[model samples]
Target: MSATVADEGTAPAGTRTEAVQALRVPVSRSYRFELVKLVSQWRIRLLMLVCWLVPGLFVAAVSLQSTLPTDTLFGRWMHASGWAGPLVVLGFAGSWALPLLTSVVAGDVFAAEDRLGTWRHLLVAVRSPRRIFAAKALAGLTVILAMVAGLVASSAVGGLLSVGDQPLVGLDGHPLASSDAAGHVLLAWLCVLAPTLALAGIGLLGSVVLGRSPIGLLLPALLAVAMQLAQMLPLPVALRLALPGYAFIAWNGLFAAPAQLGELLIAVAVSLAWAVAATVSAYLLFVRRDFTNATDDGLGRRALWVGLLPPVGLLALGFGAVAAAAPSTTGSGITQAKVERSVATSFAHLYRLQTEQLHRPAVTEAQLRTTATCDRSDGQVDPTGPGNDWRCVVTWHLPGAAAPGNAVYQLDVASDGRIEADGDGPKEVNGYFLVRSAHADAPNPLWQFDGDVELLPTSPKG
Candidate 1:
């Protein structure tokens, strides 16, 4: 039988009490209605299809490329296993893709009613505005979870079918057995859930306040991008943590053998906090709102300030909470081991790029026999925290040179994993580095200048 509240005058007192009690049940029919309405939409179906298809296609296409797309997390493993395909998409989606997909439904849930000129009629038909709000929120959450499921299934299945279930590779150059790697893939997807939920709440807020599709859809996604750019700035560490964007990539740690989760946990906390705050604020704004005409009334100066204040206030709360509760150090922090890895890996990668530019294919990090040892100026420094006075001595192969050459770098390593180095050597001459010696017929070795090289992070780019 259908579960619903009884009309006050129509039902006997006993029946009314029973109905009220029944209405307290966790899964309300009203919420089911909202889910049906949302999932049945044609665009939602198309989005699910795209979500399922894009990752598999991306993996297959990348497998054919001559070089890996090292800039993205799991990109290096496109050729590794079908299991890794899902993770690659997760990394790719960290920026705008995932947020935009999430916003597609969230941004539309409430504002869409305004767009259709049905807010008044819908509100009038529903007995309680609170119930309607609950239904809508539940429906959006359901869609987000469903989309994530589809992505996971499609990527996993499609990758397994296309590439086969091979062993997976970790970010630290270690390999995992296929059976064990499978669990981490699911966990990796779950890690992204925190940020995805946060974006949904932001979308719901945009819907409640703006009551317009464009603002509701684009604003939250744009804000997410802005948060990332904020992280890139040379701001204080606590300030960066306050913005939810910094934590989006914390899942990259899950792929590690032991799984470094301290940073990941902080990011999850901040993102969940944002999600709860945004959803609650959106609900409050929605219940208090006076729904008028779709085109003429609330679209203008009427709704702007009312709708704008909640999000701004929410951001302020996030910033303040992070400042007060989160540590001054947001990331893993700079360490000697990390510095050595970054310098060696980046130097190798940049050297490869340099050699490619010089038309030398034989030069590789392995053939170059690259090795590095790094130390902070203060020999007894803590393994973590920012340090400007880092030095790394590196030795590598240089063709036609009597012996291997060395580069001494005075490095400045930031907490965010960006490295800058000043070097004095034959390899790095006037900010230029040699890649290869001249062929038998040529006169001089080819070199790549500092401006020509890009310093990549030791961490995944997600």
Candidate 2:
């Protein structure tokens, strides 16, 4: 019953032929073979180790700091709650770390065989190019999943141990207890997997066509950086939503009260489509390559130079197509209506913060009954585009006030749905850059407030 390869080799000629035939039977076990090879690599082992260690080191560094990274979401609360640390790390990792890590193994998985001069022998052992490609892709995906797991586990444990479990402050300025914050963090991490898989597909395609480990590893990572840069510019909302990179920031929607789902839904759909298209393209190219002549010098210098053009050309073409389809007047998706909703909500929240500092009666966002009217460029143009010239008057009904009070805020709205608002205020209420508290002068929560609106229109909620 135990038929080893050695036993088959020692069998009679008829039995040896039968054993060979049996081995050729379509048994897809190449996944195991690829996994073994992948795990044995020093780089992969090191990557896993880094994933586990980096969070602890990062938490320790943050714990020793006096100031917070306020620019990053949840950064301002890192000292106030342990739960905030992981969210800050998640933001940083999505912007820079995750894309590069995804490229490392995915970009090299197939090309490494070409470098080792093992293609022919591998072909003989597997007997199916399709199986080999499938195996490699699956193994690469497995490694990505593993890396994400290690990071989430390490980050949560490190933050909890270093800072202790406390309530987290949401992007909407509401507090989330540790129990609910844990769920939101976990979901946010899960949302990251979609775009990350899309990046892996790009890396795999690079590995298949370029046959150079360095080029494969670097190209996807470079593209990710380029996307980040593009996000900062005034691009069309439809185009930005089509990009997989936007999904990284889309996770922030989960932490907002009355969670913004429009952008998140679009991001998941676009990212998955990219993953499927890239993977299929890579598979077709891999199966059709002439392995007999496939030396370590995969594409010649000229071909290698040519290989770089596709990714660039595809990016350009995609942008052009999306831009053409979007309306010139309403492309940015930042309308006066959406801005008014966001401004009113943000003012209500910051007003409560100011009230707390003054030791006045506590106010709830709902009880404030806040509303905003915004205009663009003094109403010279349509109040629907992103610009620094938007001005808003926010009115709120506070308890015991005979008439509603209003405050002016100058807003700089970005194409990416972020709004930077400065209170041009009655100093007694909105205060200046700093407000004196019992302890010391703290940054005025009312002076400058930041908020993000969903690109796609959704029903406004308090």
Candidate 3:
């Protein structure tokens, strides 16, 4: 009787409960379980396989086509240099592929549980909503990272192997050695991580809020398309800068002579802002969600209304910030002097390349003493902001020539500071569409080339 009483006293209240909690699975195990679940899905396996193989296949297709896809940023150089392939693909992927890649898995992860009516079972087994959310998010992120890795790696290797390893031409027309180009390519890919994560965050929020697999999977891509369209519109420069979509192409600055960090920095900021807001909102909703009604239609109407706050807030916040900052940024828009300097600099470098390709005497950028004057075709009074109808006349002195030579180029300048110039000329000089190089006929780098100008406030001297 004494022993029995002593044992009963030692076994305090909730002793069995404590043991049960201890025996419950940790978050790490849950994360692994989520990963296994993802891998088992046929769609996820297909996505991974596509990511690994598409780049190489695309490279091969490019090689086979008689005409290059010059519409893309680096498309014209894809066959001539291996470094261009990955860049062209990057340009394409940023618009739609990246958003779809992120949303497919993330948007479906949570909603799939709801779709299959497994939420109750999962919660009972996991015992903590926080743990389940963390595990699912972590799993989705891991899959995203893997997909990104597979695409980048495959693209790099495919470009180098399929297109012979040749020197990459910088936006300034200066040649980049293979090693240096490799580094820039890697950094450019690294710069995209934050933007992709932001999209993933958006997808996660959609999954939790919509509680439907199809809608969740589609929300991110649809949002991406809408943002892209917004960017194409004639929005204010400050407003456009605030959108995370621009970050997709901001990596172009990395290839500039003096890497343009201003826009790239803005991109990082906006992307992180979106990512944090979306992710935090999703987390709050997921934890507070009522899973008692685990059926597909069980998510309450109130939660749906609350779930909309993040996106609406984000847009209002972005627009409000830009509107607030607009007054201070009025004078900082793109100017004629900036365009003149950029065109002069790019033309000088590209002219040198043309000369070398044609077996003419070599000339340096300094030796060219290039200068440019530009005006808008629309006869706009300002003629300073982004427009597609800009025209420029570039003049330069050649070695042993008494008089200076001039070339005319039509410029289409984008809101994001990218300038594409097409030369108009009498074929003898820098105007030929194609040039005969020592190896073979190649697209003339001087005929049509791209350049970038900084979007920051113009200095007094500029």
Candidates ranked by lDDT: 3, 2, 1
Better of 1 and 3 by TM-score: 3
Candidate 3 worst ten-residue window by lDDT: 325-334
Of candidate 2, the 10-residue stretch with the lowest lDDT total is 321-330
Please, what are the lDDT tens digits per residue for candidate 2 over residues 256-301? 7888876787687677767776787777777777887855435555
Best by TM-score: 3
Q: Which is the better candidate, 1 or 2, if ranked by lDDT?
A: 2
Quote the lDDT for 93 in model 1.
76
The per-prediction tally of clashing pairs is 0, 0, 0
RMSD in angstroms between candidate 3 and the native structure over all alpha carbons: 3.9
Alpha-carbon deviation at 305 in model 2, angstroms: 14
lDDT of 1 by residue, 28-92 (tens): 77788789889899999888888777766777676656566644556556665778678777766
- Provide the lDDT at 183 for model 1: 88
User: Per-residue alpha-carbon lDDT of model 3 for 214-307, expressed as tens digits?
Assistant: 7777988988898888766666666766777778978888888888877788787888888888888888988887788646432557766766
Per-model TM-score versus the true fold: 0.70, 0.83, 0.91
Q: How high a TM-score does candidate 1 get?
A: 0.70
